[model samples]
Target: MSDERRLDVLRAIVQDYVSTSEPVGSKALLERHHLGVSAATVRNDMAALEDEGLIAAPHTSAGRIPTDAGYRLFVDKLSQIKPLTRAERSAIETFLSQSVDLDDVVTRTVRLLSSLTGQVAVMQYPSLNAATVRHVELVSLAADRLMLVVILSTGQVEQRILELGSPTHLDDEAAVAQLRSRVNELSVGRRRAEAAVALVAAVAELEAPPGDAQGQSRAAVLRAVAGVLAEQREDRVVLAGTANLARSSNDFPLTLSPVLQALEEHVVLLRLLASMDGESRESVAVRIGAENPISDLASTSVVTASYTAGGVAGLGVLGPTRMNYPSTMAAVRAVARYVTEILNQ
Candidate 1:
């Protein structure tokens, strides 16, 4: 048999089984598809595919179903992810554009992906490690108190309220404005890692006119700016459509309870996304059953794509091994692209 014909049979079996949840036979494959082969010819091809371990006969008289290896091949080698229809694209823009902030975008993305794919959705919060300083704002509330806000290109906001060591020194509005300007100048284009170090030197070089008051004021204001910009960032993820998992509860041989447990653990989901981050944006990362390192998720398949707005993050779907790879991949890719566009905006 030709390799092309054999793969065609495997594709037909996978599609039929995925749709009907029933073992596929030569007769049904011929009936539903234009394979241009006789029933006997298809049956012979099925036997060849089964021998290759790509498709398996579930029972003595049953037709064949794609094994995990089969599904993986079908996803990696045979499938062309269907493109989203015009209506689907419009829905994505409408749903995501309603977001008010970074948190809102990530939150709505999970819901949108889950609804689109009919599976659990996972969206990793954008990594701020590569983020550049976007803006810095300072507000003085009291002689000794001021609020410093640090905004990053990734849309992460950090605030540090400073109780000035010498309140009277930083009390002047002009001093605060000068300090804010210097901080933004030094930190705005620098990466998060470089901002803290650069801001400190910029403060020290400030040419304050001689006097205890002016000197003390410069020192106090600069200290507040540096303090607020220096801090560690933690990576986070948001998930939605977990209830969708319950719909496929019976699909798990051991039970979906463990899968649900895995979702609740953020570390588990983060690591899962990290594993998939290496793939280029043009192709979706698909981790099939047993391919997942987590034993609880061994029965599930994860499809993810890394997104870059300010930095690299991840978004994808989690579904049963029997998922419709083509359509699900399309939904994930479309949503991840829209999310990246939204983040960059």
Candidate 2:
């Protein structure tokens, strides 16, 4: 038989194994698929496929199952990503459109992906570098204390409170207006490097010909701005669907828990996403069992792709090895596309 026919039989075996969670035999392959081959011919093809290390028989009496290599070939060569059904699309749309806050959107996104795929879902919240400052307000709380409230386009709010060395005793209204103007001039849409320079320049421009008391207060405010912006490197990772792993056919202790453990570590998770690097936004990467160096992640497979907004790209989803690759990939791609749209909006 041809190589294409051999791969076809291999794909058939993987599908059967994934669905039934059983070892697939040649007789079963021929019976279930119209490969136009007899059982003996199918057995010969299975043997050849085994020699190539794509599929293996578990024991002398048992049937065959695809190896990690087999799964990779199936994903890279055979499986066509299944598009979301209209019902599934509608469900996702309704779930996301109802979110009122960033926390709600992320929480609902995790739950939605899990329910749809029956696998653990991992989502990285939008990074600060990609978000523009929507507004900044200064609220005075004490004789020498002020609170800086920062609102971003991504719907996250951050506050930095400054306690001056001594009270400036300026009119509250005037001080707030000056501070707001200073903040807007300094820390807008520019990322860290540009923002830091802008901040230093803004503070310098506001410093001179001012009282020593007010200078101390302004210095405190600038220090507060520096501190908050220093934490820009911190990124958020949101996880859900871990409970769904209990439903996977893979043996729990041997397969699931380690994968779960790996998912729990931000460094490991970030490393996993890093392994899938590329500039092509349209490509979908499939890392099958054993392809990931983390032994705990070996039994698991991950399908990852990147999404961009405001020229910044972030990854979405770390799915299972036995994942319905076709549908899950489609879901990731579609969601990434829509998420970019939403972010742009």
Instruction: Give me the candidate number with maximum TM-score.
Output: 1
After TM-score superposition, the amount by which residue 112's alpha carbon in candidate 2 deviates from its true location, in angstroms, is: 1.0
Off by over 4 Å in 2: 78-80, 129-132, 168-175, 210-220, 249-257, 277-280, 309-320
Clash-forming residue pairs, model 2: 82-326, 301-321
Distance from true location, Cα of 306 in model 1, Å: 1.5
lDDT tens per residue, model 1, 135-190? 98888888777787878887778777877766546567887787778778888978
Candidate 2 residue lDDT tens string, 1-345: 798999899889888887887789887887888999888889899989899999987778448988888888888784467778888777777777787766777787777776666777766676776566666777887787777787776766777776665674544788768876777767777654455566766666556565565665675676667566656555676788777777774533355667777877977876666567462256777778778767788778777667664344445555555556777778776666656555546
Q: Score every model by TM-score.
A: 0.93, 0.88
Every model: Cα RMSD to truth: 2.0, 2.8
TM-score of 2: 0.88
Residue 269: error of model 1 in Å?
1.3
lDDT per model, in order? 0.84, 0.71
* Total backbone collisions, model 2: 2
